[model samples]
Target: MQGNQLRTFMATEQLSTFNPVTLQLPCGMLRGQRLGDVQRFLGVPFAEPPIGDFRFKAPQALADWTGIREANSFARAAIQSPRPPTLVPDDPGYSEDCLYLNVWAPIAPGPHPVYVWIHGGANMAGTTAQPVFDGTSFARRGVVFVSIAYRLGILGFVDVSGLLGEAYRGSGNNGLRDQIAALEWVKHNIAAVGGDPDRVTLGGESAGGKNVISLLTAPGAQGLFHRAICQSGGGQTYADQLMAEDLAQRVRIHLGGESARADALLEATPEQLLAAQASLVDSYPAKSPFRAVVDGVVLEQAPLASIANGAGRDIPLLLGWNKDEAGFYGASANGDGGVVQQELANMSLSEFDQILIRYPEMFPHLKAEALRFKALTAESYGVPTLRIAEARARIGRPAYVYRFDLPPEQGAFRGLCVHTSELPLVFGNVQLPTAEAIGPVEPAAQRMSGIMHSLWIDFITAQPILSDATTIWPVYELGARQVAILDEELRIKSDPDAGERMAWTTWQPVAAE
Candidate 1:
């Protein structure tokens, strides 16, 4: 055990294989490797592979196995292209059998807090293997981190029951059901990986955040998580009531198949279905109709309605939106010049005039751009938070609200903290390179990362995020609403955008021409 001899032994041993062990899941015993003092399990099947006969159907329980399965490499992600055009790599893979989970945990015996991450891709795209999503940082900090893969696109959220029957009644929420199954797996198996099932925190950004809200209202997901962090994607209002069914029928016709039923569509290949779904996106200029349906069972009712009636009353929540969420939407709408122009054109004369009435001087030069930004800010983030915050306040539950305003350093999008900007920061992986559309992360970004991650850990452990280093985050109140503005320096602001808030408060859908 001399110093030189010990050094030689350490050099020879692979750090990732020091304390390997087997995890006994309902499906099988999986061999998990070790990294430093933590045990890492990747690509563990939480549910049956959703391929062939199971595609588009609700996730099924993983079948039992006798041998130890290798849990090391990440499984194939659900069929999806990357986001924002620039982020999509040259050769990204896709598949139907993509229901899997990755875990990072301390190699100790006692149970520890667990953080389950749901990724953001607007409910259409995104995967669990994004470099920024690596959970090792959180695991290194003594929290078990889990990243999960759920169904996406047509396979994930098409409502065909209107044309089908009770067999396909809840098909619209298949993606959501996949998430619940992952949580159920965590509840039953996290202990084997040294995680406390009781202290699970469900969190995500954008579409992932939307999923967190869906879980909050979904009855099947009750008691599966104790704390929730929804960033940037709060306050999702379903685009239209018939959108889900309409999208499904479109898919059926595009496939050139006679059967327009949900069960019949399940027999199609994943690629064929995804192509059909993508075609719909190309055809529709306003918005994609594929999203979680308000089924009387899985979703029960609109999340806003549930929150209004105290659905997730006991669960503590940390929710917020970014300052420039619409910037990203504008970038995504690049190919559709007509859509972008129409949106910009409508911003001034549309309902957003109420917003212009308040911030008439904010961006005097680019009137249309400013108007589009304000309108989107109201609908996407502002109104949703107002609705949910009022619901949470009414139910007497502790909730903290925040607004992220850390602007990017380069490009026309400079000074705007667009959607998904907080992803790299929250995960403490801001060092990763950003694509063209997403500028490089600044050196000062890590400070905000530390703050956000620490607050999240504190919330999961203490129910209310407590910190002495930053501003005291107060529980949101309906009337005297207080919000913590996250930036270079945290500031406590009251009614930061009163004009935009009032606009969303009185928002109503306009009739289609």
Candidate 2:
């Protein structure tokens, strides 16, 4: 059936009131609510709470339960600096014990393809509870969809390995560990919930996108997911272990006294820890302080290097980035007069340095200010994205590359396809604040949503796209670089970033150093 046709059928076959349905897994019996053809099971913990002495430890397996467990409300999001009420208005609550996942599967007779999504907020913020990530549309399309929550900020990414010892070597990757645990749960138990565990495709956007890349390099994560999708991500690599440990030492000193033991962090209040996290931001003004690092246990190699060496060469990949991802971060730059210079001054060594040095020869048409943002967009999202596809292709793997160019109405965002603009469409979140608060729905956007969702469902289900196509999404080769440009009208473009791509030919990532 067509994606839209399936949705129409689900809409008409809905029962306004329904009873809770139960499914038994090895761990326990879960009671989920039925809405139309989809059954939602929320706040299902795949691992025990990482609290108290276990705060910095790896996730412990959950104890088996005998009775029916109510999977209704969302668990608290990971502890981090709170976002503005506008981003996540519902406020699902926040805490350190936030390793829960939500499942959306059709009430089908047998197993269906599974899509496990990792939520993205730069590894610092975001939760599975966000309304934008609801999996109903995918479920209605006969796919089992799951969204997982992981530890965030200092709690999730900080490297405490050197100071905390062997038991905590993987602390820096706990957020990712939580994701792997969720995937493991899906592999073992999803079949009981009408999901085909072996047919799982793992994906995410932004930080979640980066996590998907990291999982590709993780030895423990091999074969957990059969396919991977990385959208507007795969730029940053894990921090070098020594650099991360130094940062962790500074944080430890800030949280506990100079002579305090590592355990002092355990004794500190949550507010104290948050304050220390803020201090780390102040210390590393140029770079992000809270992120996964090469802690030697979970993440042993850099993501791109591993992929380039064939770690993910066996996996089918769908990788792409947005057109103007750096638009949203332009305001974070200094004043217009010296904005570009100030951005440079704040950075000791970044991809911008290489781009600026070669800017005149590579791209002389764009102004310095515009070029700065453009370079940033390319470096952070575009360039690495192209390189990932190119790397996978170099290793004889199949990868389809595309760029999302559809812009929202000419209003608050000024028609720019800023960061995260494709999310509402990808999630099929028609009721998102962007639609409600940004302005009335543009007819093109509504149509684009259906197209994007259709393409995604096709990839997830391992089915040919629509069965009405003249061409399959072409493999992105080095020079050809054919990209399926997604807009109101689907078009194909070659070398979307000819200038930027050339500029970055010699450009090096900060993490690569």
Candidate 3:
């Protein structure tokens, strides 16, 4: 197509005042679209397509190209199972060759802090194409926002190193390695788009949040990002080598009975692999089979353990979870039934009894299942979030903890600030169509969005987190246990749930780091 037609197409597609601009970076020249003050470079290949020979392997850096590549449209999302009704895919399709990143930057020049986002889906789903993750608000606030897509499910997290031999040594961590590679690309290329490479903040939610914590312990990921924001993700769920291999064995069996060889994984179609993964996941509904493995090379130690031992101690952290994290699973068909119970089964019987006994005393008004919901919410998210914060506090590092208290005023998730409720608020996309599916905008939502979004921007910009004149966000402390309670009105609370906190003190939820 001619240059004029290309410009017209971008303008029409973006549905905004589009000024086609070309940027020359280390890898290649990219033609991006500019709407008003924000310049967006979508579908930018940070690495070569992880397909064919690179399939199920770590990502490779993109080689230099001679001509300008059109980065106007988003690339296909990573191949995975279908999303629930709440999630809307940003891309038109899904494919194995989905190693791409999107950048939203201000038109102004000079260095700006960067916020690199990694989407979460239990290491099985999600894409950078989601509308809720759009970086326009962040860009308008003078922060360059970049979101990336990595391999998922069996293709990304299944450990085949033990069966396929040494070539795929970090096979289980392929998605993480992809993230590291993207950071490396950012380190060398972000300045061309008015972003400071040294001031990059890595952030994510759910599985993406887990990856942020995982990357904190990854040797290759060191110095790639300077700060992190982990939402509703803890460092307790990683699989050791043996466990990863065991899960891989199950996947192999589902791929093709007992006789299937490891080599056959190379020839199986994406559809067949996804089908087998579905079966494997169904077989173990309670377990997260495919996640980061504690391979000595890629991830030397568990994230929580490493953080406790001063790993990434210099990096400031802003992390938290929603108050009703388990409500999304319970009473909602969004996930498997009994997941809350399955997750809590890891606790000792005595510890379980202690929590069970406290439920009635702590919440006298709640019923049995409602009480269980509160217990699971605290055990699953609150415990781990505080654990990481305590680790940081113990080391005299900066850490800000928060709990999202306000539930959506509309939708099926009304009155429940369930898992992933903060995405639209943090991204300041609460009015977007996809966000509407999550929850409609309420009267106080705009103010809440400003409060949450501004706090994130303050962190990314390394400015003081002044949410409002009266509210002062404090660093987490071992004594005070101060937590920012985010809602229609921002307030600080000390030991919000003292009862639950006291109960979990006798029982350690995760293994020692």
Query: Whose lDDT is greatest here?
Result: 3
Global fold similarity of model 1 (TM-score): 0.87
Give me the runs in candidate 3 sitting further than 4 Å from their true place: 1-14, 84-86, 89-91, 332-354, 509-513
Q: Per-residue CA lDDT of candidate 1, range 180-266, in tens? A: 999999999888788999999999887788789889888999999998988865545453336666767777887655565545576
Predictions in order: lDDT: 0.73, 0.77, 0.83
Which segments of candidate 1 are over 4 A away from where they belong? 1-21, 82-92, 239-241, 257-264, 331-367, 411-413, 434-440, 463-465, 468-470, 508-513
Per-model TM-score on C-alpha atoms: 0.87, 0.91, 0.93
Candidate 2, residue 260: how far the Cα is off, in Å? 4.7
- Please give the ranking of all candidate structures by TM-score, highest first, separated by commas: 3, 2, 1
For model 2, how does the per-residue alpha-carbon lDDT over 42-81 read when each residue is reduced to its tens digit? 9999999999988878888988988999997788888877
- Candidate 3 residue 150 C-alpha distance from true site, Å: 0.7
What range of 10 consecutive residues in model 3 has the weakest lDDT sum? Answer: 332-341
Model 3 agreement with the true structure over 337-428: per-residue lDDT tens digits: 22233455235445666766777887788776676667777776788788899999999999999999888777788888888888899999
